[model samples]
Target: MLRPRKFKELETKLGHRFKDPGLLERALTHASVRGGKIARFDNERLEFIGDRVLGLAIAEILNQQYPEASEGELARRYNRLVRGEACAKVARNIGLGAHLILSESEADSGGRDKTTILADAAEALLGAVFIDVGFEKARAVVRKLWQEQSEPVPEVAVDAKSALQEWAQGQGLALPKYTVVSRKGPDHAPRFTAEVIIAGRAPAQGEGASKRIAEQAAATALLTREGEGGRLGDA
Candidate 1:
């Protein structure tokens, strides 16, 4: 059995106590260590419920905070915010990784630092909180946990064209150029087909609702091809 002192410390930090601390213990336990023992429930089911709770809480937060933003914009921010990397970052910030119980083999393989595991554990903890109390209490807990740390998400320029151009620049290669292969549809919403041509290789083609977006898609395809061939320059 896990000790109460550590859980008490965690509750102090989190500003809430579990009526049933076993839920939290289960949330921290990984399947790698637990083999269907009655006392050893893994956090997978908790992760599933927590995922929904997280999405709803984040959506409500975004909707309330950014009333004028389009749903697409809100969705983009939400996705970036709730992604594995983001969740792992939060887990690290809260020192949740320290509490995880994994098998010796898994721990030897660096399970403590694994982003996927950390993120899953964080979600499971949220679910545990939800189960221990209710949605309103869960929301309060989440808000308190995240509010001080939350900041506006920076926009990622991860589109293909930018990646390709960066790759070219890093390799001292010639810049890529994009040309429209075809265009169709109404003036207000045209579909553009673009071809991205690298200096020494075959051009890659992509289509999007806009020329810039299509060019970016094409650039991404070209980068993917180069990556597969082991030709992309060092990051």
Candidate 2:
């Protein structure tokens, strides 16, 4: 049996008590540790269930928070909130990585800090909570942790590429350029990596499910970097 003290610390962070602490333990177990066959117990099943749980909670929140917004607007906001990167951010905020129980080999390979792993585990944790308690309790946890953290959704939802273009023009600079760095994953859900280059500045990269989305991600990355003191060339 896993130690009670370990789960106690995690419960404190999660803001919920688990009658079956084993549920939380299972939620934190990685498939890599189980040799990819989770017959014993792993986060995979929980991650699956949690994905739907998370989506529903976020949809409900967005619907309530942006009452007058169009369906398209709500969809955009929903996508931003439920993306893997966003989930990983929430996991980091709650220090979920510290409680993960990885095989020695997995931990040595830097599994603890991997964004995909953390995001999956975060979802699994939510799933475990839903299973242990119920939808409403899990939802309350999600709302408290996630509701106030998202950047305000724009009314029209401009793509990142257009936003960056307008910004560069306002600064009297040449238009920014984007390049497809790589494409990987299966055909059904390929991942695209894009790099955005600006005059006299280091390139910033981003990844997404499509070239256009990747380009938008790249532009957003560059803009965020520049906003955080990564300078751009003057007019």
Candidate 3:
């Protein structure tokens, strides 16, 4: 049983106490910790739902704050905000890594500080909040953690894959092709390397927790290799 004070700091940070503390417990429980359980007690299910919750919340924010922006423009900002990287960043900001409930082996292997674990746990936490209360309450927590959208419009958050595709079209070149070169590490926490090949450009590669993120990374790598202006690259 978790001590009543165990989650005090996290609860304070979230600005809401859990009505059913098991939700928070489940959120923090990593898959590595579940020892062959028949029931799904880990955070994975919560992470799944939490991903949707976070996306919905951020989409709502973008809709209201960027009402004048085009769909593409909104998508860029939305992608940037809802990414695993952003979620990990938020987890770190809230000191969420320290609270992960990992198995002895996982903890010894530094799973607590891992980017994927932290990001998934962050989403699970949000999902737990949603289940505990409702969307309005969960959205409020997201808004607080993500902060008010009062800053000037950010320009650097463009979706790299989209930009790469657009660049290829603009240049009258074949579309960029992404291939998963390697997927390594444990199933619970996998690492993927993906390569991007454009018809006239030298292939570039990047790695991430998932194939989609790896593809994005590969696109970003190709873009960076080209030029600051995303110019043509050497074959």
Q: Which candidate leads in lDDT?
A: 3
Model 3 Cα shift for residue 219 (angstroms): 2.5
- Please list the residue runs of candidate 3 whose C-alpha ends up more than 4 Å from where it truly belongs after superposition: 1-3, 148-150, 157-159, 162-194, 197-235
Q: Model 1: runs farther than 4 Å from truth?
A: 1-3, 36-40, 152-219, 222-235
* Candidate 1: 10-residue stretch with minimal lDDT: 226-235
lDDT of 3 by residue, 47-144 (tens): 99999999999999888887788765665677678878889888998899889899999999999889899999999999999999989999988998
Better of 1 and 3 by TM-score: 3
How many collisions between residues are there in candidate 3? 0
- In candidate 3, how many Å is residue 61 off? 0.4
lDDT tens per residue, model 2, 33-64: 78757455998899998999999999999888
TM-score of each: 0.65, 0.68, 0.73
Tell me the spans in candidate 2 whose CA falls farther than 4 Å from its real position: 1-3, 150-157, 160-235
TM-score of 3: 0.73
lDDT of 2 at 105: 90
Choose the strongest candidate by TM-score. 3
Q: Candidate 2: what lDDT?
A: 0.83
Better of 1 and 2 by TM-score: 2
Global CA lDDT computed for model 3? 0.84
Q: Write the per-residue lDDT of candidate 1 for residues 1-235, one digit (tens) a residue.
A: 5557878877776677898899989888888987666543898889888888888888888788778876545655676567687778778877887789898999999999899999998888889999999788777766766674445554444445445665676667888888999999999989999998878778899899998789877876787777732322221
